[model samples]
Target: MQRLTVFLCCIWIGSLMYGEMVAFWRPYWKCSWPPLQQNLTEVPHSHEGFKVAVITDPQLTDYTSHGLTPGSFAVKAIQFFTDIYMRRSFRTSLLSFEPDEIIFLGDLFDGGPYLSDKEWKESAERFEHVFDQTQRGSKSRLTGIPVHYLSGNHDIGYAGFHSHKREVIERFEKVYGETNYRMKIGSVEFVIVNAQTLDGSMNENSTSSSWNFIQNISADANPLPRILLTHIPLYRPNDTPCGAYRSSPIINQRISNGRSGIQGIMYQNYLSEDTSARLLDLIKPILVLSGHDHDQCTVSHPTPNGPVIEHTVGTFSWQQGNLYPSFMLLSVSALSSSTTSNPEGIVSTNLCFLPMQTHIYLWYASLFIITVFLLLSWPTSGVDLSYCFRKLTELAATAIRTTSKGGVKVKDEDANYEYDMVWDAEGVMHLIRKGYSKLSNANHGEVRSSARGTVVARPAAKKQTTPESDSSCVQIESETNLEQIPKGPRMTKGKMSYIVQRLFRTLHNIAVLAAVNLPLYMMLLIKDWT
Candidate 1:
């Protein structure tokens, strides 16, 4: 018993020491191992080359940004959301240091449709509120330097839906330029292209090389660095029978509504569309900036012809629990500064991991439970070996007798716990784990797509549950009835309370003994060594 107690104490102490380390422990995980990228890159238009910040798909729908209903809040699945905020913060901070131009990649609004008209108005109002805040003032990255923006698939009504798509565009154009235009910071030229047209993608022989329209500007310096701004990037090679260009969005819900018989088709516009690759091959300019994927990544490629570097800035807010926020801050040197101090250096990227508030709470709770467990194993110096043995044996016997009859029966109050359905984002149903003891054991279908599209061949979708529908019927269970209890060493609040109280008492007794016997413990150590 003494040896066992000593072993357990040693283990508990080790755990206690590492508790803080584990609490803040961030695992070393990089996105996309060996990121599929090309090496041999170059710095384009070094003289007037400036760092431009890009952020896309803020997706501030009623549900996402300002919670759909009053007092409504959405929690995320994991830690990535912090990355989203931190990435933006980093970019902003860098802008403070490097003083670069900035741009929003687009999709500023999410969920253009609200079932209730009130909800729709409220959603639009909230968007204007926050976006105004984001776009206002000279202290922010948007205002301090030159901040430009473009439109995203989500921002423009997700395809021909009646909403504030045009209004939103107008608001943006009023602050920035008219969605599509050009500007020259110095030797490097910037062309803001609104690639938000729906028919640009699906319709065959659409005479829109919308990207090509920007290149024809008379003010554009040929063979000088030209940076292109776009929302969706096209890098994947086109495989359609028509042999179109390609760079596929991982999962694309159609930008328009003439759906094929599927959820949504994954597609790339053009391998070398008006993007950095094509711009590099054509204008032979330097860099390009884009947003939409909301993941921090930089790809520098050396084509057989020339080299190009492109960076994708992440989103600024948490969405669907994936925190991806990043920015590009550049120090634009005059053509004279090319020969001065180091031209390009990465100011801090402030890629903060998601905030650990929730995880920390659970961690501390588990540690408290474990500490109580350890203290119960402590030895009592006052009792003789035989006396201690007798006391433990008696307690053990009493526990056995109590447990044999019936152990830990759950109460009726627990079985009657209820959960309330709140807002209607696409995926809040899966996040019910936040409310403890409210989970139903229902087997849902294997499908993950929340949308059903035409032309895109996907499995049949499960219908959305209405207020009148019995969603509870879809829950899985081992037994047929709702109130059926499983046969086991059942858990009970009363039993847990009793166990916890006992552990607490044990901890108090151990602490008292340790304090009182400090001198004796030291003397014993000396004597034993001697």
Candidate 2:
């Protein structure tokens, strides 16, 4: 048991040290591992160097207050906590990357269809607080950073339907301004396309306008390296044989209607393959950034002009469908100041997956329980109780001894009483024998001193000495010392308590290791140690 305890102790201590080391390198852990590094040699741009923080499908929502039914508060509380964590993590990642600007590629709110005018304003306020740095009284972690917003099907209904009403669109415009806008950073031009409207879901006229806008940008007289920013990725050739790009959102009972049943066959989240191919041909964009599917993917579709690359980033929020949280950082550098005519520049994109340490929660909970158990498991001393029991037994034996002298005795029917008394009496006798040995040694020493020149008979000296009286006196003295023997037992009890405390501490450490999955980290530490 002792050896096993010591070994577990070492593991526990090592686990703590390992935890501290990881915490110290937390920033690196948050950004670097599981990173996708790609140099977009196809992208044409020019700059000293600029970084764009690309995050998609934030889908931020306060689901806690949504559908307020019985026992919904717990779900709401959890959602609230998750929202806070995700927002903070997103902000931290952006700051870590030090992006010049940020692009939120849609579904900034989960219930865009259901949001009232007031709710829309509130959601917009939260968006500004989390993502926009210029807003006053904002909790924006990044200052002086500009953010571009894109509209997803969740924000407004699909192109071919009125499921998302015009009033909802009006509310959205009040907060985020126009859905489709353009911006130029460095030598590159970014054209934001409203995919929801581009699909002709609201009206044919809106679709025609979006198409015309794309055409105008594609036919720019002095076109720079143009990039398309939208919420849905263009369909790949293999997405489906018949023409739809991918599966649609699950139609649950709450949102299902007369027109919703067969909608899965016509995916609302993805653009048509034909439209995608046409857009690629027209713009001849080097890179396309999009997000609607929570999965991260990069697909290259061959166009008549060239191959257009679409990089879809994963969701940064916590949800049932979100497998892992991720974002992309696009870096652009200018070839030269005079490269406005020749806007081909170096572009590198790194897709970063945030570390998801879900096991740490379990580890913390386990440590707390173990600590509480150890505190309650403190060793207790039963000295007073044992001493009282011993005194009672001694008294009973003394009564029997005194009565035996009179040839009379009380009936002692307790079977174990006699056995216990016998053991106690034997212990007293052993002490008496020890006292006698000590007295004998003292007498022998005195005889040796008195008879240094002559041989002295130790037996004669023993006989001359009245050892009966001496024995009686020594026995009384021994009894007095025995009366104080409880102190020795008390010291022994303290030693036992100390041992128990050490054992509990060791157990606590082991519990922590088990909580944190010690074996995995132990291997990591060993590898690093070597």
Candidate 3:
């Protein structure tokens, strides 16, 4: 038990250290820098490119998922651990890449569209806490980095559905700013679009507003390379491939009507074909970035002008059905001279994968199971108690022989007789009777036993014996008499006491183990609870 306890403690400590300090951070160190599409050195005195971190589909847990009940302790606990994980990953990415700006592609909350004002507020608070970089005294590397957010179906519901309530949209915009807007960082221009509105099934006003936003961007003659950021990916043929980084062989394009009463489409795998074509033609974006599938995908859309590459960034949260969650790092350098052959500026993008949290959890679980098995099987693991007792008896016999003084030594022939007559109940009774006869003879008196109508007397011829043999005979007789004595009530009480003692010992062991390891487990879940 002591050994098992030590082993379990070691496992707990090791797991805690690795899972918390090493596992989550090692991947960042190992990740190579994003590969640049074109060498910036060719451009005369090209400046360092702007680095942007693309995070998407965190989809923070809510009442609707993970068997969670609103306002319950379980929900809070799950949220707490999940938030801690996200915070660690996000912080690690920020420190590793040192991105100048961060962009969230969407689905910030799992059930944001359905949450009430109070629930929404709580979820938003959790989101801020997870991504908080400006807390007082926080030396976070991302403290001053600008963050941009796009509206997801989960955040503001799909367009054209009554569930896509005006209140929800307003609340989202109030916190995250306009979902559809344009911003430029360094030499590149980013056009953020709310693709949910492009479905055309939405209200006339919203549909036109989104179109007008796109049209306005398209009409601009700004020569800077344009990048489109949206929550939904542009449409492609049903058989289109999502590239090698995708976990699934094929992207699931099946349309879901969902509970939102948006007939024919509740959630979309990609934007409608017409909407995708229009955006490509009008915006003429050199690159399209989106998130909704929660997996990495790269697709090329053919256009009259040129082929546009679209990268669908994977989810950033480990809970979103992805074992290996990741984010994108994009670096764009604006060329100093537009006259150069390639004027769109050198762009490089890489997918930075976070540690596989599920694997870590499985390792912990396996360790726990192994510990439990060892503990439960410890009692009977090895050693034969009966054999040990027999060895002890033999040692005691040898001790008695060694301590005995010199006496008459029996002949070899007599030794076999003595052994045969001194090892059973009847033989023991005969020995006791014989000794009594000898004592009676020494006293010069006849002996008689009337208890069972039996009589005994010493024989006329006397046999020689050793004092050791006499003492052993007496001891064996006394033990036999004691065994013959009844101890029914005492034995029953002793057995009950033994069972109770064993139960207490098992419980004590389990309690000690739990006490020792509980803190370690809690540290893994809430290391930054404050």
Candidate 4:
């Protein structure tokens, strides 16, 4: 039993410590762990598998008010604390994934609606600093990965609410290029759409042009596996609201009338009733991806072409509903051209949630486990609970007195100052005394000399005492005098067993402490990273 206990403790301690070290190293340096791979429906075309990192709703901002006023400083201070350092963390995590390409599905800015002329320019500059390709002799957070940006409700405008002017749309297009565009990578056609356009918030001409482009692409004689990327998900599928609907199903049902009573930005943030059906019929996109709800979810709908799967990726913003920052890694295999009727190649997607808050849960779990282990492994004979409590109280008092004096103060009376006495279950009262200085100076030779022949004499107490109690109460003559003390009796078989048990209990306590505190301490060191 002892061997097994020791072995288990070693394993637990080793695992906890190793996890702590990795966690500590992760925040300062990028993690080297491989990205998780998720498998999708297999396509008929033969092609090599490639990785795509999908990040959304970073909503990056300096967070200060858009004015040159005194209050801006206060607002900036508040925003500083609230900012999750999304850029730094995102870069670190993305580097770890080492994706071939990155696709950001919208809401790249939080204060887009409030931006002034200067603020707009600054926001554009900040966006480029964080996401744009590296220039000559410049540092780039993205290394060499190609990035595709999409416009969400926060960027330009939704539909009817917080609508942006035509000039604002022009500026966005100028910076990020056409919001609605298509790119062919390998045998796959990625269709990027501006959900804002569908809401009738943008110029009708631009919207019409995009629609025409999509139609033109769909008319291809040899179409590839189409994947659509947008900001808002299709109108609530499987009765699960992913867009601007209220979190509660009952509330959503009450508010969602025939036309969806949601007004303005919220309305534009979600698709209209027949929006998905129309898009599905037009493009026949097998896979559709979106973001803007900040909720990670997946739903499938059957169409004339095949099954269309829609996924809403989670957010990296703490300002949003993203309690834990996360992103998706998409793995797309090469398309096989054999018997191609728009080959449905397998596209695997893994939603990788960051382990930022995992340490908190692990700390709580470790504490609970340590408490249980201590209770079950405590030495009952050598350590008395009441005695331990008393000792702890006395130690606290001594510490308080020592701190007040700036150092330990020694009393003149008999070198050892008596503080208090504690009576045990055996009716034997042990007088607690302290003579820290002399105790430290006394050597083993002195202890042996004192034990050999020294005997102490003191005034007899004015209380009844038994013969064994009198023999046990041999008072010390001086500070160095620690005469042969009575420890109840010699070591018998039972006493030896008790000693061995206490030894094991001590080891158990040490092991349990290591298991409980190592990870917690490491977590404290990294809690400020993100």
Candidate 5:
């Protein structure tokens, strides 16, 4: 029991150290910047493309989920821990890659749309805390990099649904700037669209504004290659694959009829096919980046210009369904001259994964269970538990003797009576027999007789029970039993059985540990490879 306790303490300490100091930062160390066509080192500083960190679907926790109730300790604890996990990942990524800009692909909060004004403000504060740049020191990498935000269905409800109130949209815009806008960072132009409004099922005014924004951007005859950033992904067939890095193999698209379907206000998998086509046609962007499905997906949409690639980035928070949270790094550079062969300079992307938080917790849990099982089932040879108990009783009698000397009376007869009562109540003799039977064969049946004799002899002490007297009696009885016990063949067989049991136990424990942890390791390795 003592060994098991120490083992558990060591495991607990190791888990805490790894989770806090090592796990969150290890992935970033393993990941490198996505390579460009022309080596970045060879290019001039002005022409070297900028790196953008694309984070999506963080979906910060709120009272609506995780069985969290308002004003409760559990809710506060969960929120704090979750926010810290996200903050650590973000900070580590910034420090590792030092991206020139950052983009949040939305679903910033799980209950953003439905939260009350006070609740909404609190959630927004948590969002700021998770992505805060001001707190980081001047020496920090990516110290003043700009971060852009997009509106998600969770942030502002799906357009045309009853949940899509004008006030909700206004609240989001008030805090996060305009939902539909365009900006140029480095040499590439990025068009940020509120794809939720493109559904056109409701909120006519907002939907109209979104369309106008798209039309205005499309009308501009800019020479720079355009990249579209939106919260919802462009529509694709239900059978579309989300690539090897996606947690789920298939992307299921579910569309609902206006106000008549079982799907609630929150059920949107992708943009409507018509809206997708309209955005593709008007924007005519060279690339599209979106984040609503909370997983990595890459698909190509055909256009007259060429095939436009759309990459849906995965979530950034571990609280979401994804076990391995990740973000994308996009390297974009502008070309010096426009040509028929290649008008754009270069754009390359790579998905960098975060630690598997769920798997780490599983490791801790599995370790505890394995430790407990081994401790309870471990083989012990010739170590008598009853003898330990007898020693404890003798110690108690010695303490009582000292107390009696100091003018406190503890009767010898009473002590003996109490000891016999505890021994019978706990069935110590029965326990000894059961323990010995595990290691002793039929030839070692005499061990059980010796254990029974020890118990019977204890009850015979009716006159006076003292530590010295009990110790002398037990020592003489033990010696006699040792002399009478046969030691040649029977003892040799018991020793061999004990050795075999220990070997089998060790092998079984190894197999169990491998079964529990091998798949997790394989998954991390495979994801790293892809």
Candidate 6:
């Protein structure tokens, strides 16, 4: 307990002592990690007071949904989200920041637009009430502040991703009044990015015009500052040469020398991932604001020196999984409402910050190191080893029980799987087609289902893979009646039992590690004591 207290104290002090700096380090921090900057030119226009405002994750789900669900998230459905990140809270937070404008990072709803048309109506109603108050509040601000928003993975996932962004723009415009547009306020060139551009996989043609517009603005502008707004982080912990978006392909070719799709940029690029780099290099904006993850953390990347900041917004919905809700306030200043006046914002310059990284990697490493030492000392220190031995035995039993004699668990023929895409159109369609599997279960000609839920059995299903009547592999003999097909459970509940077994196995492995490390730790301790 004493040691634990020390550990906690270290963390508290570490956080306060942490500072911001440049992201130009060999390893950049995750997007929100270090608020670092460099090569930035903050030239001020003669605007009034400093502009600061707040933006948070307001996950206002459709009232009917109440943000409830089944799946890993089903467990979290008991809580009402609207009460958690209400617009009033956002209003109060903004009022405190007293900035010129407030930008929402997205996930306006839990993500889905409802399988049935009826659901959309409900979601629409709840969403309107949440956003309307804010729109009205913006008008009440001393500056009659403008409110901006960026689409997140959840906002358009139900609409087939970028494909339906335009279709939903009207709905959003009705609530918040726009999808992608830009304006210049007191020298700051604030460009609101569309949702599609953030997804690295988006087709280039869709984003080309947006980029061209910004380039034109940069060419004509003078001493004004630049700011780009969007949701989802621009970088990850694992980043190679692949910089954010525009800088990615350049980095890809440079790193793999033509090889593509190696590993997730989480470790490689750290937070300096794809698409984001392009927006940074092209826009050269002094600030970028985004959201997705629910926690509030600021990483001062590249340097351990002075004050630099990258704004990361927080979550708004309480029902989301592991995602937190929060907002930020940014001050507006020094120019005209028109884009022509100040080229840059009233303030811009070289950034500085000192980073005291939590380094979760090292945190876990130390825990393992200590655990190993404890394991080594346990037996000789006269502590019972049965807990340790029992754990190992249980793990081995789990490994044996889950595996098939030949080794390989198979999926049901009718398992419904969809793309890893934040967009789950087919999943929504399937939900709408509820009991389609059960109805067809009696008729084996189509997919099959059973009494138990083994919800998504397939690894991934692509839009292109939907079976068409003309498929060569499927026979279409008019003589063969569809009624003569076999029907049975696609898969049994027995298969999912593997989860319990897997857990035990993992625990067993930890026990083994402890057992192996115990003796070494005790030896060192005894030597010191002697």
**The candidate that achieves the highest lDDT relative to the unseen native structure:** 3
Off by over 4 Å in 6: 1-50, 62-81, 91-93, 96-99, 112-118, 131-145, 158-160, 163-166, 173-175, 198-205, 221-223, 239-274, 300-309, 321-325, 335-530
Evaluate all candidate structures by whole-model CA lDDT and list the values in order: 0.44, 0.58, 0.74, 0.60, 0.72, 0.43
Residue-level lDDT tens digits of model 2 in 436-520: 3222323322121111132222222221221232232121121344665668778999999987876766566557546565666
Q: Write the per-residue lDDT of candidate 1 for residues 1-530, one digit (tens) a residue.
A: 34534554554454433332332223112211111111114233422334544456666644434444443433232222333233323332333343366567776656443324455455446444443424323755454465566766555433233222235444445544566667765445566666554224433111133444645653345333456666765353333221111122333322333344322222233223344355455544355566665654455557664555555555655543333233344434333223332213211122223223345446646855665555564443433769879999999998898798687533444332223332223233332211223335543333322223111112222222213323332232223554576534455766787678767667664565445444543453333222
Clashing pairs in 5: 160-202
Error of 2 at 319 (Å): 2.3
- Which candidate number maximizes TM-score? 3
Cα lDDT of model 6 overall? 0.43
Residues 1-530, candidate 4: write the lDDT tens digits: 34435555565555555443444336334333232222334332343467788888877655433343533775565444334245434544554566778898988776675567677787776665554344412334446778888987778765443333556667778777788889875456789987766745334655566577767876888777778998977766345644332232311211122235533333434677576677778777868998877767777768887678788887866556556666787766554433233323346666666544444347657855774565456546435658889999999999998999988664455333222243433345554332232223332211212433543222221232222211233343334534665355554766888767767676666666567666765563355332
Candidate 1, TM-score vs. the true structure? Answer: 0.45
Candidate 5 local distance difference test against the native: 0.72
TM-scores of the candidates are 0.45, 0.57, 0.73, 0.56, 0.67, 0.42
For every model shown, the clashing-pair count is 24, 8, 1, 11, 1, 84
- lDDT over C-alpha atoms for residue 285 of model 4: 80
For 108-203, candidate 3 gives per-residue lDDT tens digits of 999888889999999999898888776424455457788999999899877655334668888999999997999987677889988877875544
- How far residue 136's Cα lies from its native spot in candidate 5, in Å, is 3.7
TM-score of 3: 0.73
User: Residue 449's C-alpha lDDT in candidate 4?
Assistant: 25
What are the per-model C-alpha RMSD values against the true structure? 26.7, 18.4, 11.2, 17.5, 18.3, 28.9
